[model samples]
Target: MPTTNQYEGIKHIARITTNFEDTCEHCKEHFIDPATATNHYIKEHGYKILYIGPESDISGMEHYHWTVTILGK
Candidate 1:
């Protein structure tokens, strides 16, 4: 069986979901892909990566990052 623990090292997270889910505040257009939208996000959307991932879900690489994107976005 797999175990789930609440306490972990990557608890810090920046809630940048609204931006990924919705359009840019100024232009008003949808994000192509929230998971790999860093380029689009930073360039077209003018978003800064204030936080460098290591988000709460320490389950795995894709799982951790994607969970935030799907649920949050």
Candidate 2:
């Protein structure tokens, strides 16, 4: 068992894009898709996806992006 404080400083946000250049703010890794980026945080970093933000347009890039909030112990 772990206390709430154990998870402090372990929450992070990952930005995933549909243009095959996804980025994870915690690990600083790039992925090709949202699934890969999410899985990387879960599997490799032992983090759980807490929230998936709504898709947002990337201005003139013509592609959309979203944020994935994750937390770990």
Candidate whose lDDT is highest? 2
- Local accuracy of candidate 1 as per-residue lDDT tens digits, 2-72: 88643334333324442236444446555655554444556654454544333444555544333233211
Candidate 2 has its poorest 10 consecutive residues by lDDT at: 11-20
Q: For residues 1-73, what per-residue lDDT tens digits would candidate 2 score against the true structure?
A: 8657544575454444454576677667767777777678788877765555665676686776655444453
Candidate 1 TM-score over all chains jointly: 0.34
Candidate 1 Cα errors over 4 Å, as ranges: 1-15, 18-20, 52-73
Q: Best by TM-score, which number?
A: 2
RMSD of 1: 12.4
Q: In candidate 1, what residue range of length 10 has the lowest lDDT sum?
A: 64-73
Q: Each prediction's Cα lDDT score?
A: 0.44, 0.62
Candidate 1 clash pair list:
none
